[model samples]
Target: MRAVVIESPKQLHVTTLPDPTPGPGDVVVRVAGVGLCGTDVHMLAGEFGPTVYPVVPGHEFSGEIVAVGSEVQGYAEGDRVAADPAVYCGSCHFCAIGRGNLCEKWGTIGITMDGACAEYVKVPAANLYRLPQGVDLGHAPLIEPLSTIVHGLDVVAPSVGDHFLIYGAGTMGLLYLQTARRNGAASVSVVDLNADRLAVAEQLGADHVATSADELDRVTTGWEVVVDCTGAVPAIEDAFTRVRRGGTFQQFGCAPDQEQARFSPFRIYNDEIRIVGSMAILHSYGRALDLLAKGWIDSDTMITHRFGLDEYQKALDTFSQGTGRKIQIVPSLAPGA
Candidate 1:
């Protein structure tokens, strides 16, 4: 087997390794494609706290089951699936309360364990969700990130006619826009630093797009729901101010640990604003898969680039440069072939 290993922060290698064998409760998936996301970038930089060294960094993936564990049931070889990467310590306080995303010993595949950035990777059978018939395997990786959107919206719990203001026009932001529209948002507006991304947002159903919130038509009271998907302190801070009185604001982005965003505490108290933070996927995996199957996401437009396992570094470079959306690694392909 060939895999890309992040030996440590700032160090990586593509090398041969023994093929993974499934445990009694796990299955080995023959890699199809893995989506490259911001989390993977943070893992490579050692910024993601749960990341373990020498790990294979890829979590958003879809593949065909090649080997099933003896104890696994209701699934078999040749099934196409996507596994939820989140691994939780089931006995933790948070897990006991059914909030495993906040588990004390929370970990994720690709960050803490070996992942699918290779020809084969082992996954817990319990985490796997089979792709619907006729779905493109290459597009299935979007389901993982889409699940995060599902979780975020669950936290927002917006009214059917509420207006939405989202920061960032990248993959996450755009997905949020589409889903918000489908979820009955009165209107979805987006802001981004990139004009190209803003354009994509408009094409994907955003009612308004701007480089800054000041440029958009101001709702008399403010947007009913404000979401920050950039994870940048500036965006987060600005998003807070856009929330209408008594409205909700969601921090859906993954911000750096050392950064802080400023907000008016008095305003929150006086306006009765609701502030919520959405972490990774909770119990939304199946919902996300179902949403994708129902055609809620434009997977064709979301995925923009693909690379082989050997081109992992180049894929990282492209992702960092914001050259494309939803870049993926098809482990079975040869480099530059």
Candidate 2:
């Protein structure tokens, strides 16, 4: 088996490794496609902590089940599936309350555990969801991130005919735009410092796009809802001020652990603004898969590059350049291709 490992910050190496086998109640999947996400960049930069060195780094993925443990039921060999990388302790207080994403002892594949960046990866049977018929394996990797956006929308409850202003035009931001539009936002606008990303956002159905933070004033301040996907301090701070007095503001991006944004206490007290922070997907992976399987999301358009497992370093370099919206690693490529 071939796998990509990050020994340390700024270091990605592709090396031959032993293939994985399923444990009791687990399944082994032959890697089909693995999506590179922003979190992977953060992990590579040593920003996100608790990532084990020399670990395989991928979570958003799709694959075919090659082996299933005897204890695993309702699944078998040759089944096409996508995985929910978030592993939660069912006994935690959050999990007891049906908020597994917020579980105190939450662990995730590709971060806290070895992930699907290799020829074969082992996952708990409970985490595997059967892919819908007719859904290509190439696009199955998108279900995880798309589910995050769907979870955020579920929390914010953006309604029909509402005007939405989304900060950042990156992959998550663009996904938010499409989700908001699908939820019936009369007009959805996206803001990003990168004009290229804003163009991509417009192509994805954002009614308006802004490349400048100051340009937000041109749009109505009375936006019905504002979502911040940038996670930058300045952008988060601006979101607090740009949302309408009574509008909802949702924070869907992850900021640095040490970074903080200040807001006026008086304004928050007087404006009646509702601010919500949405974390990772909570029981939304199924819905994300359903949407993808049903053709609600154009997953093919989101994928910009695909590389063989042996080309993992090149994939990392391409991801670091920020030129592609989404990149996937295909571990089952034919020899010499």
Per-model lDDT: 0.91, 0.84
Cα lDDT of candidate 1 equals 0.91
Candidate 2 backbone collisions, by pair? none
- Model 1 per-residue lDDT tens digits across residues 1-337: 9999999988999999999998999999998999998888887887777888989889999999999999999899999999999999999899999999998998898888999899999999999998989678998999999999999999899899999999998899999999999999999999999999988998898999999888888745699999999888988988899899999999998886667889999999999999999999999999999999999999999999999999999999998887778899999887886
Measured by TM-score, the strongest candidate is 1
lDDT of 2 at 190: 86
Q: Which stretches of candidate 2 lie above 4 Å from their native place?
A: 213-220, 333-337
* TM-score of model 1 vs. true structure: 0.97
Residues 114-194, candidate 2, lDDT per residue (tens digit)?
A: 898888889999999998788898998989999999899889887678889999877788778887888888989888878
Best by lDDT: 1
Per-residue lDDT of 311 in model 2: 80
Q: Least lDDT summed over 10 consecutive residues: which range in candidate 2? A: 212-221
